[model samples]
Target: MVTIQGIAFIPQNISKGGEKLYILNKQDVPIVDGLINLNSDSSQANLSEAQQQLDLLWNKLDLIEMNDELKAISPAMAQGKIDKRLIIVHRYIRLNYGEPLTLQLLADLINCNPVYLSNTYTKLFKITPMKYLQVTRMKKASELLKETNMSIKDITTHLGYVNNSQFSTIFKRYFSCTPVEYRRNQHLQMRSIGIF
Candidate 1:
């Protein structure tokens, strides 16, 4: 007789994947037990229950099928499909510029291979994720420089830079001036234009 072993309840963790559930037996670990993802609209309390529900659901989904109208829009549908995932990853990186956002973390969040994600992201956006992150940090640094009187060390720490020297080098490379010079120039330019 089949016995219920163990259970694993993985919530709707987007960083792990889409909405998915994994169940294992006493001997089977969560990672090894395999998973049954609730793709459409159905519930899987258990494996046999999941199989039964999915089989019925598949038939229903197949009956509706894709028509000529849907076929014509397949590319659009596919583009939209990937675009949402891409936007989510991009926005997360933009919003978490001060965090240690490693490539592995981003890959897990977006549910793709790190190398593939890196290559595809670079191809689609014309920049690597690290490069994008660096630019994002620089943007934040620029905003702080223009708006606040924070010290160089403070800006460096706020931007998650390892040290002031690294921050200053990148800041200079991007703005053609050191942080101090950049901040000074920004203030003088704003005052000259009555922007302050």
Candidate 2:
């Protein structure tokens, strides 16, 4: 059984080399950004139902055989395949920046080993995945500080920080100012410009 974001599936027939199955979730499906440990019996039952539907669909579709030319392509030529997964990871980080995220959890979400994912992501984006995640969080926090009246503690908790001090520390490290100082500076700048 393989699960992505709490949705589980049982592969009826998996090839020795593994088959790529692209899943497009519905628009309304709640996106889970955190780690989901599926150990309950209900989760198992849901997986079984989903697998039955997938198998039925597979049996109904006509399978196509790849040509020898396509089959002859080396694994090195297939490097482009990782590009989409990397983009997905980036989008997930942007959407779920408030969620608890770690290298292993992100790799598990994408079905890749953490080391490989880290190396490939860093190579392609010129930034480590965790670094990117931190940047995303900080950016969102900055926006919240500039635009909202939420307290620093509230903002910190909203961004999934364990405490105000840690949030303030990271915010200062990233923006060269603490949250309160940043907000005060923003307001002062706006007032100086006669916009407040």
TM-score of each: 0.56, 0.58
Model 1, residue 48: displacement in angstroms? Answer: 64
Q: For candidate 2, write residues 105-170 as lDDT tens digits.
A: 999989999998899888766679998888768867987887679999889888878899989999
Count residue pairs with overlapping backbones in model 2. 0
Least accurate 10 contiguous residues by lDDT in model 2: 32-41
Best by TM-score: 2
lDDT per residue as tens, model 1, 67-142: 3224534565587744456556767887899987899999999788999888877755557888889987987898
The segments of candidate 1 whose C-alpha lies over 4 angstroms from its true place after superposition are: 1-83
Worst 10 residues of 1 by lDDT: 1-10
Best by lDDT: 1
In model 2, which residue pairs have backbone atoms overlapping below 3 Å?
Answer: none
Reference-based lDDT, residue 149, model 1: 85
